[model samples]
Target: MLRGSGVTTLQYTALTVLERRGGISAAQLARDSFVTPQAMADMLRALEQRELISRSPNPASRRELLVHLTEEGRRLLAEYTDAHAAIEELMLSGLSRAERAHLRSSLDGAWRALRPPR
Candidate 1:
């Protein structure tokens, strides 16, 4: 559904992570997004080329580079938020509100269970 938005799935994943975490190192972004370091590097290069994200040396750790979303990136994400919601609504149309809530809770629990111990 977000294909025409000029953002790939991996790019969107990275953006979502940045949106939640504010700014973080590229490596950390890769880890959070569940992508290999090399794949994350390539995705970051593309995002940077699109002016959707910026990279700069981390002030706290010069050895690491911090990645952040730009205004354009945020705007794109905001635009797609409604589209995503609509898709979810359509997908869950057959389910009652309570069922949807229960499904969401179950999915959240499953995700939490799948994550490694922090």
Candidate 2:
């Protein structure tokens, strides 16, 4: 459903994570996007080449770099706003507001439950 936008789902997922988290390490982006670090490294290269994202040395950690969405990246995400809303509407159309909230809570709980021990 997300193809043909010049952006793969995984790329979109990484962008979304960066959007929400502001700036984060590539490894954190990988975990949040359900991808391996190697895969995220490749994706970040593509995104950077496309000018959709930028990375800079982390001030708090000299050895780490934080990835961030660029203005173009924000524009790209905004362009899909309608489609994203429509998709969510279609998926939740059958449920009441309360039920939707419950579903979100359940999903969050499941996500937390499945995470490996830190």
Candidate 3:
């Protein structure tokens, strides 16, 4: 489903990680994305060439560079995310937006109540 958007699963994972974590080091990104350092380096080069992400030297550590997702990266991620909204709309066609929100909240609360403590 994601490849249709010109992004592979690993690339999508990298973008999603950036969206969630904001700016972070490439090594951290690789670890979070479940990729090897060498694989991450090649992926970073590809993402940079596509202008989906940018890298800057980290002031705290001259050896590591910070990675950031570009607006275009967010835009691309949104395309896939928006599809979920459409699917939800179809599945929840009988419910109003408010009802759906309430249902989601109730489900979350139930999950919290049932989950064992870490």
Number of the predicted model whose lDDT against the real structure is largest: 2
Task: Please say which candidate is ahead in lDDT: 1 or 3.
Answer: 1
Q: Which ranges of candidate 1 are over 4 A from the true structure?
A: 114-116
What is the per-residue lDDT of model 1 for residues 26-116, given as tens digits with 9 covering 90 to 100? 8788878889899999999999999999988889988888999999999989989988789889999999989999999998898678656
* Per-residue accuracy of model 2 over 1-118 as CA lDDT, tens digit each: 5676789989998999899996899988888888999999999999999999999999999999999999999999999989999998999999999999999999999888866678
Predicted structure 3: lDDT: 0.87
Tell me how far the alpha carbon of residue 101 in candidate 1 is from the true structure, in angstroms, after superposition: 2.6
lDDT, candidate 2, equals: 0.92
Instruction: Mark the 10 consecutive residues where model 2 has the least summed lDDT.
Output: 1-10
User: What TM-score does each of the candidates earn?
Assistant: 0.83, 0.92, 0.69
Q: Which ten residues in a row have the lowest lDDT in candidate 1?
A: 109-118
Off by over 4 Å in 3: 84-118
Candidate 1, residue 97: how far the Cα is off, in Å: 2.9
TM-score of 2: 0.92
Best by TM-score: 2
**Cα miss at 6, model 3 (Å)?**
1.3
Better model by lDDT: candidate 1 vs candidate 2: 2
